[model samples]
Target: MEGVIDGDTRALLSEDGALDWCVTEFVRVVDARLPPRVFLRHCPELATAGSAGPITPSATPVTLQLLGSDPRGLAANAEQAISQGVTRLDLNFGCPAKTVNRHDGGASLLRTPERVYTVVGAVAEVSQRHGVSVNAKLRLGFDDKQLALACAQAAEAGGAEELVVHARTRREGYRPPAHWEWIARIRAGVRVPVVANGDIWSLEDYWKARTLSGCRDVMLGRGMLADPWLARRIRHWLETGGERLSPTPWSARSDMLIRYADAKRDAGMAEKVIVSLLKQWLNIMRGRDSEAAARFTALRRETALAPFVAGLSDLGSSSDSTSSGTAAHASSTLAG
Candidate 1:
């Protein structure tokens, strides 16, 4: 969500009461020396700009997530992040980027439980020393589930406060059916709180995943990207029954795009940056209907933001009456 869910985008979501907790994109830990501003910039959720108020309230407690293979470097960076007011620490073992895996940063660590233990141990030591919670998000395995239980158990032994298990192997991209049942096995195997991830896109999906995983907490990814109101809907359905939150109106969508544009403008982003962000947003908005899909496809072809958002505004206004603003069913069609 780096290029997409930055301060401006998150601020837009927050205005709509969509997102709760937001994590910064992984600041790859390459060495021990990390600048203080880097933490503030990347974890902007902890800064005033990320907060609800103009400069007083923080955006959200942005967890500084780091990805690397070295325990010493991870621990050192974790220390610096804590000193910079990072509320939480997340170790990434699920990213499937080619460069990341080539450098053994993301899913590569899943291949070695010993390494996961060592890295988790170092970070956990720093987390406990600083009184900050440390968590890990992992794929089931690089190639199989046999190592998943071992990898999960090792993280627990190494002092991870919580674990979010994505129920698919690394080979599986955002394809079809996710292996939700595997979360059940991992939960039974670990002592720490286990958050079920992968394939949860709607309220029914939430209940089904909970039943399959035997767990309550879940971490949504692509589903949330597709339907920004997913978590809010899940929260609403859990508190009530059959009551669905409506989508943000067309006027609100127009306002959101304008506000996001202004935030990006203040951030000193290039024109291309604004275009890219709006294009990604259109892709997410495409989850609505065929008209939105065509509009997003058209928007992606352009090299501007103003026109793209305007087109989206038009499409949103037309679809508000016919389209389900939030998810109508619980499914993981956006799963990857």
Candidate 2:
């Protein structure tokens, strides 16, 4: 979720109650300890109550995520972030990016469970003094799934309050059919809560994952991006046993994009960057919605935020134009 789940995206998702909590994109730890400003840069929510921000219609607390191999440096930075009012810290051991692994960060640490233990232990020990919670997010293993049990044990022994298992090895690289049974095995081996993650794109997928992983908690990443109402739908289904629901219509989805753009603009992101982010979101949505694909095809080249907003406005207005009367009314109701 590095280049993807920024503050704006988090706000958009949180506004609709899509997440109970969010971890900011990884703040890299090198030889030197990072400053408080670096944490603020990644998660501006640290400036708010309970390290929370107004997620539009609602608010959700965000935890600071750190990625690195150096236990001391990570501990120091985690301490600084905690001192700056970050109430929770999540260590990133699941990122599969080649650049990050090459630099001895991310999933490469999985090759050595002791390093994971040391790093998590160091950070947890520091945060525990301040009554802050520490957690770890991990893949099954580096290239082999057999190491997952030991990895979970390491994280627990190192004082992680909870563990999130992404149920895929680094080599798997987001392939179809995430192995959630591996998460079940890890959950059985560890005493801490194991939150299941990976390949959950719908309510059905959520139920399937919960059954396979034997986990009550689940985390959504790309799935949430593909369908903004996914979490809300899942919550409703869990409460009401409803039938599968369709995605939000084009007009309503367009309003979310507009709101995201306005939030970014208000935060002082340049027009070009805001436009690029909008296009990125649209591209992701295009895979699931034909209208989004059509709109992205029409405005992918736009370099200014004004034109992008105008294009979205046109897309929203015309969404019902090509539909039957009944469909047009449904779209109008959704927009309203």
Candidate 1 per-residue C-alpha lDDT over 29-104 given as tens digits, one digit per residue, 9 for 90 to 100 = 9767588877777656555432231221223344567899899999999898877677578898988777889988
Ten contiguous residues minimizing lDDT sum, candidate 1: 327-336
Which parts of model 1 are misplaced by more than 4 Å?
Answer: 16-20, 48-59, 246-255, 315-317, 322-336
User: Compared with the true structure, what per-residue lDDT tens digits does model 2 show for residues 1-336?
Assistant: 556687667777776554677778889998587777787778877666453431223566677789999989998998888778888789999999999999999999999899899999999999999888899989999999878889889999999999988989999988978999989999999999989899887777888999999998888887777777777777655655464445567876687889888888897889998888788878878887888888999998889889789888774444433211111000000000
Could you tell me every candidate's TM-score relative to the true structure?
A: 0.87, 0.89
* Deviating ranges (above 4 Å) for candidate 2: 50-57, 243-246, 315-336
After superposition on all CA atoms, how large is the RMSD of candidate 1? 4.2
Cα shift from native, residue 221, model 2 (Å): 0.8
Judged by whole-model lDDT over C-alpha atoms, candidate 1 comes out at 0.71
Which pairs of residues have clashing backbones in candidate 2? none
